[model samples]
Target: MEVLVKDFPIDFVVTWVDGQDEAWLKKYNQYSQQDVLDVRNARFRDYGIFKYWFRAVEKYAPWVNHIYLVTDDQVPKWLNCNNPKITVIDHKQIVPHEYLPIFNSNAIELNIYKIDGLAEHFVYFNDDMFLNRKVKPIDFFSKRGLPRDTAGLNAIQPRYDFDYIHVNNMKIINTKFNKKDVMKKQFFKFLNIKNLELNIYTILLFFWPKFTRFFDLHYPYSIRKSTMKRVISENQNEYIQTMKDRFRSRHDITIWLVRYYALVTGNFSVRSPRVGKIYDLLTTFGEAKRDLTNGKHKMIVLNDDANISETEFDSIVKDLKNLFEKKLPIKTEFEKED
Candidate 1:
């Protein structure tokens, strides 16, 4: 089962923004539609707990060869940019000049594979997602070098503006792959009983001849650098046009397209979805908090809601910071010493 990709050095990529940074806010407002961007927008709010994400990585996934902190030239005041294991990537470095000053994470993420010195095996993480339990390199990629993932079925039930992006990804995917053909060729892999929770969903969607949607997980996306490069190259025009967006747009295709491509092409290894879970910060605060403290999963996403008031959001963040401190108290080399 050995392969060259399995032996390649693995890197971790996480995109971050200091929503409170004046320079960043200025640029955000300049390009934002409201003449002034809403500083209180929950998506742009600076939750105080991001530091623990680095600490958790240091504690839980110490074997990660490098950690690339992708940002729009805004580094956290606490981040130790000089740390050898951490590289600060500016959007200008990977994205073309035309797409400079891009605030769209989808656009920035699409170009991460262009990172200097990035390895063949890499995983992309959102700031809110953290390595909760100790993990091995093999947890992300298999011995044969496929990205380990769960292939669960989900219909596009768009509840937010971003959900439409999944539909875009699906349209492109369905055009390139036949559902019936993929199912038959990769029957055992897709329906791998190891992922018992997904089997029922696969069976129920058996009649659908097209990929309506994939159960898009908020977990750190396990990606192959070559795969990303290939996906972008295949849909170059679509990506090029979409990358110009200064903010999230319904026209854009997401990184989930890469996952779907790999799944249909049988380039991924199946795993259980239970390894990581996403919990709402506003609606499931206690449940998410309890799971974090209990180390209930290997990864967790504190999915924030923009509808909550700033006061409530602040309180939740305050409590979350305390919980993370209790779990991963010691500061790592990634942070500046007080």
Candidate 2:
């Protein structure tokens, strides 16, 4: 008989913002400039799919010990925040008072470890990421309570349309670790057969003497609270400067720092990157709807691409909402009764 590591309690921390809220909108408009990449309206506006995120969790990954819905003093009108399984945490709970009124997602995430009673093992999620299948705790954590992750490496793409944040992340990683030493120690994890398929770039740059940028899949991250705390503590000053930004900037390090920290330090287990995917609504709306309707992946990120016009984005949102309603029509404990 085998003793299973089934009892390890893991928490779920999801960060969300309601762009349409009048108070939040007022502050946002007052502080944000049109040029900042992160200020794009698509990042904040919520489609009707949020409630279904809750429904999917309740239906699929029911074993989650606790759920922290981190927000900006905002809760969905349909959400029952009082439910024992879910807690709505404001930015003030984790971010410092001086950083109050923070609009930067990176700044908000820099303080996530401060959440009261967060578990040692936790999964961090963007509001857009959702489970599409019945998943076990094993999918996130190994038997020893390590985060299961894809440790593939890639070169930094200077032409990446978004930001230079990954370059910043790699500079820190290379300084802290030698590629050879870490690879020697974590050989199986990096070269893991499951972790190999999507990592051709990883193998191509495998011997580059330094750690290159990692293949960042847009999905939930399985993280260790202690590892997150240690990384922030080690890089306190840089992070402090990053926290001062009211909106995102190219110089700021995103949550990928935490993921990279776990990867280099052997705090994670090998898992395939294909566990989920990111679907940009502008280009992939048709495929996204089909995947959602068919439950084609374990998780899928329905990205609100800023490149598309608002009218087109809204049309896609309406279709997505209808499709989600058809898939997960019933309300669960996370929602208030109709």
Candidate 3:
């Protein structure tokens, strides 16, 4: 279903980091304590996958107006700064001075909408996220200008845990709304709370069988810049808390809050997700290879969990390069000349 969204002019934003940069490393190690080094902070690994990501976008999402590469004053040597459609944004351009030398993606995401001259409609992509198939504008947004959301019941029962950031998200939601009212509204169905009646339910079915999971998918997020701004303006306290935590603290809220806020405010439309196969490099290389050969998914995530060894990691990178060479062999205009 093609929506006449040419006038909307959707843009793309990607956050990338090079962990090996000496200056970046100095600042990271300076502020990072031993306990927060590995998991809590952004784990930088060079997969050399950005080229393929550009190729994928050029091949599949040609309608994208501009590609904003958000980085901490780092740029790929092979990128073409002359490209009219690509903009490399340094952290200082959008992030405040005090938050300078930031390493956390969660913190960076909060300020993405603040980028000057950003399009009202934009897609946020992690460096690892890619568009594997041709998708129309309606796939992300409706003709009415509402973001299409794909969500699932939480895989695990929802509970509060100081170590888990997602649990912290749930805590904020529960605390903001009355327990019985949240349960009665059917937590999953509380997208719009304008006329929610105060009621009590002995069993909170939404949280019991499974809570609504908003952050599970690793896909390009369809975001509205104005909606994000409004959410931050309305929820100053929560937004401040989210921005204060430089790393992935348990008390910090993830970008999922923006999506949730949009939903609850009737600014988005929920759509059944057309999710493709997911392959974790730490465990499922064989299956990933088979699926890649078969072209089984419209999107694929090559996640680099810190559990793998140096040799295994190198092997995965080799396999990924081979796959991309065979699949997306064309060099994009965004690449520098040889």
How do the predictions measure up, each by TM-score? 0.95, 0.96, 0.85
Candidate closest to the true structure, highest lDDT: 1
Clashing pairs in 3: 191-264
Off by over 4 Å in 3: 34-37, 40-42, 155-163, 176-204, 207-215
Tens-place lDDT per residue, model 1, 1-338, is 44333367889999988888888888887777832222337777778788999999999988789999998888888999889999999999999998778887778889999999999889999898988889887789988778999887778886877777888899898888889999898888778887777788888897797888887777999999999999999998779867967677877887888898998898999888888989988898999989989999999998878777878978997899889989999999999989
Candidate 1 has which clashing residue pairs, if any? none
Candidate 1 Cα outliers beyond 4 Å, as residue runs: 1-6, 34-40
**TM-score-sorted candidate list, best first:** 2, 1, 3
Clashing pairs in 2: none
Candidate 3 accuracy as TM-score: 0.85
Q: Write the per-residue lDDT of candidate 3 for residues 1-338, one digit (tens) a residue.
A: 46765758888999988777787777777877733624532268778878889998898888888999999889998899899999999999998888666666777888899988899988898887766777777767778777876533343354544237676565655555444554354445442232122112212334453343443566777899988887667667766775666765656666777776664445666555454446788888787777666666666777777778878878888988998889889888999989
Give the distance in Å from residue 46's predicted Cα in candidate 1 to where it truly belongs: 1.3
- Give the alpha-carbon lDDT of every model: 0.85, 0.84, 0.71
The C-alpha stretches of model 2 lying farther than 4 A from their native spots are 1-6
Q: How well is each residue in 212-326 modelled by candidate 2, as lDDT tens digits?
A: 6888888888888888898998888779877987777776887789999888888887888878878988898888888898888899998887787878878887898899889
